[model samples]
Each structure stands twice: as structure tokens, then as C-alpha cells.
Target: MTRRVLPYRTPSENVISAEDWHLVTPDGDIAAPEALPDWDYRMNLRLRRVVNVDLDRARTESGLPADAPLLLSAVWTATGSNLSGPAQHLRLPRAGTVPMKIDFELSGTNLGGLLLLDTALVLAERRPDARPASPRRAGSILWSDRRALRLQGDAPQFPMAVIDFSLTSFPDNAAWHLQISGSLESATMGALLLLVNERNTVTATAFANAAKPRQIDRLVLSAVYADAARLMVEHALSHEDFSEESDYPDDSLGATMLILFDRLFPDQSITDMRLRQRQSPSLFASDLQAAVTIFEVS
Candidate 1:
């Protein structure tokens, strides 16, 4: 059946919370591409975030062209916890010109207005002529699994597949790691790990060619339980269509929460986890750390 389609527009409301990173300082900015402070010459800055995938549904609805070789004009903004009045919009390419990639930066500065963070991204603008870039190149990492999973009955359960991730500066713990766990109610169903970062950017997103979420397990310092829970609950159920659903906590919310809780606190068990969420995270590896372990839910 042909799904309903609508013209996409920028979302009227946004807060830059979940997927956002910290700030900038005399030393350096959190999300900026700039390196860590010399500490001798500069004081460590606060936090300046670069929300990875801006999955702004309205914009996705309005901006992207309907057919192949789609040209999408987008705005990437970096807001301060300080609440500075304006955001920096990267200069986009002119209509006819195309870069080797869509590369841009989120720069921050210190007391003297010294540059703190400068998050540079070489994103690929989806075009008929262009080949695909890995998810890490397009945006943030969700979950990456080389192996498949079969949920066993157990606690302290490892995820059948794993959701790997990171914080602002690679190699360090900008935020805590999120450990996830999921279950398959029956033999007929499929298994997935839905990772979410709502408080951040909702405008920039990259989906795999297969249309499944990519995995990014190579980043972050450590994996913890609470972070895992948050990733799961805030997630939305999605389809390639991009215009069918209303936004929110959602129908599968209770069930998703239950699955997370059961995996975290396996003393409780569930049979069904089939409501829906917003988006799915895919595979990713950090430049900082090469190998992180994947968790499975028994």
C-alpha cells in the first residue's frame, strides 16, 4: 500500500536536549573539533554540544526532494547552556556545486573569544551521483552488531547485540556509557536495539541503505545501566516514510520501558515488546577507542 505523504517543514518546537553535548571554555569546547586544553595555557571550558543527526521531521518532510539525487538544505545549530541568543548556521553549497562531502564545523570559544570547540563534519549529501558514506560520516552512532542475538533467560543479561556510543570528546567520558538489553517475545518476531538521543539534534539523520539503523559500538568510555534505559525509552518507532506518525512518548512506550527494565532488572520478564518507537540506532566505532564490548540481554 502507498503510505500517506506530506511536504516536510522544520519542526516548530525544539530544545536541543538529549543528543546535545556540553560547552566551551578558555581551554576548549566540549563538542567542538578543537583538541583538549593545554591546561597549562587554558582552563578547561564547559560544554558546547554538536547534536549529531538532526532528524527534524518537519524539515525532513519539507526540505528533502521527493526522488533520487535529493538535495536537502539544512541548518546545523550549536546552542549554549548559557543560552546565547543566536546559533551559527554553516554556509551551505550553492545549488549546482557539490563538495566531495558535506563538511562543516561547530566552533566554540573561551573568555577572550578564543576558539574552544570546532566540530567539523564531512557529511555526505544524499545524491544520485554520490556513493554512500558510513553512518559515522553522516551523523552519530547508534548500535553496531557484527553478530546476531538469541535472548536467553537470565539477568545481568548482555544484549544479544550491543549498542555502542560516546560523549563529546572521544577517548574520555563526557557522559556515562549506556548498556542496553532486549528480548524477543516469541519465535515469529524480529529483535532490535532502539537507541535514542532526544534532548539533542532532531534535524540531521543518516539511515543505512538497507533502511536499518547502523551500529556504532566503537565509541565511549564505559557502559552503564541507567544510560541504557534512557536510550530505549526516549526512542521512537520509525519507517522510511518519515511522515506517518505523530511525535511523543508513544504507544509502545510502556512495553519498551518494560523490556528495558526487565533486561536491567531481569527478576521481571515480558512476552511482548511490539508497540513502536521513533528511531533505531546503528553501528559505530570511535576514533578514540577502537574496541568496546557489546552487551546482550538474556
Candidate 2:
């Protein structure tokens, strides 16, 4: 394994010990897995972990004053939304081992793709009178660890909400609607939304119990997925810049659309598909329906 070499003297590898993160769920907390298929835009991710830091050893090895202050911090970044923020922060003891428990919660709307959690031990304040070859700057890293959780699943990943359709101009009976906005170059998180009407109990409940869907729920979800895929494909084809040669930013809507297009129509050229779509819209609809395999089980 490759290790980072810091500029100044640092604590040994055993200075910090951290437990694996746990995912909090309705049933109980489970060890966080490589991926969460049931996660949706409406859900929130709750995670917990414990960390133990040898503060006294850290200070002594780094040649710092005994009273030097330290900090333990956790920060999170979401690749899907291209957003990041602090999850938790704690002041470390000046001596002896310090055990800290961190409970972190993040909204699904602001998260997508991969969720990365970074925990670090750093100098809380600058020490001007520190010993030679020691870390003296504030926020100087002493040690750190990182964990990742994949948020993307089989479904088209995007933000979502459940509201009454009657509240707006939408038809009261409409089951669901995908609202896509902004330019293709815009961030995906701000570009797509899956809005489910609460009046449509079947559709709403399918998403609500997505983590543990029954057979009937699977059927409903399959239908929704098919329709949503159709809408996204049509939207992508409508744009002239959505071509194979077009390069979009990693987190852009165009990039997401390109991924969906490739998945739905692998080895198919965008130009050929676009021409077919324009010449025969109905045929295109049928083709998309077949590609999504609506109502089919895995």
C-alpha cells in the first residue's frame, strides 16, 4: 500500500483507529455495503462510526508541546452533485487516548454517484513556539482515513419528491412526472427531478418501500423506470449537441444523458438513432419501450 509522506514529523500508523461505518435503517443498523440499491432521492443517509486517537503519542512523536490543541474532523463529498461539506468536528484531548463517536446525516437530494467520507486528525491552532521539524500550522494534517459508499443503483439516479399533483397545474390523477430543466452543461443534480404524485398511492408506495419492494411494487417500479428512460432519451435526442464527439464535464447533465444513452442503446450510434427518432416518432417510442424492457423481471 502507498502511504502519503508529510513534510514534518507525524504520528505512527497506529495513532488512530477507526471502525467501519454503519448505515442506519428502519430495521436496524447494518454494516455499510459497497452499494445501496434501495437508496432514492427522497431518502436520507444516516451513518455512524467510532474513532480512537492517541493524542499523547501524536504530540510526543511530532515533537509538539504537551498542551498543543488537536482536532478530529469528518468531511463528506458527493460526486454526483459535485458538492461537499463538513460532517462533524471535535476537539481532542491534550493527553491520553480520545474516543469519539460520529453520527453523520446527509440529504439524498444533494448526493449522487459516490459518497466519500474523509476523517482527519489535524492541528487545531498554529503553535509558533513548536519544536524543530514539527507541524506548526493550523489545520496541519497529522493523520486521515477515507471511506466511500456507492449511491447509484439500477434505476436512473436523480433527485425526487412526492407531492400532491392537485396543488399545481398538473392533472390530479397523473401518477408521476419527470421535470428536466437547464442546459446540458448544467449540473445533473440541478437538471433532473422525479416528482411522484401522492394521490397515486401505487406509485408513491413503490418508491416508499423501494428498499424492500414486494412483487407488485417491483412491477410498478419497472413501469416507472421504463417511462422515465423514454423521457430522458427523448430529451437527449432533442438536443443537437448531444453527440458522440461532444464532451461534457464529468458531473454535467450531458454526461449523465450520454451514460443513459449508451446503457439503453449500446453499440448504437447517436446520429443513426437521432435520424430514426426524427423520421418516425412512434417507432422510436416502441424502440425505447423495448430497450427498457418494461414490466420484465431481472
- Candidate of highest TM-score: 2
Estimate, for each residue in 198-278, the C-alpha lDDT of model 1 and write its tens digit. 222221122111122233321111233334434443332222221212221211233334444444434422211212121
Tens digits of per-residue lDDT for model 2, 127-214: 9887779999999989888888888665677888899999978899999999999988887877888999999999999998887788
What is the model-wide C-alpha lDDT for candidate 1? 0.26
Error at 65, model 2, angstroms:
4.7
What is the overall TM-score of model 2 with all chains considered together? 0.79
Per-candidate alpha-carbon RMSD to the true structure: 21.8, 3.7
What lDDT does each candidate get? Answer: 0.26, 0.87
TM-score of each: 0.18, 0.79
Best by lDDT: 2
Candidate 1: residue 248 Cα off by (Å): 10
Candidate 1 residues lying further than 4 Å off, grouped into runs, are 1-72, 75-96, 104-256, 265-298
Q: Give the 10-residue window scoring lowest on summed lDDT in candidate 2.
A: 35-44
- On the 0 to 100 scale, the lDDT of residue 34 in model 1 is 37
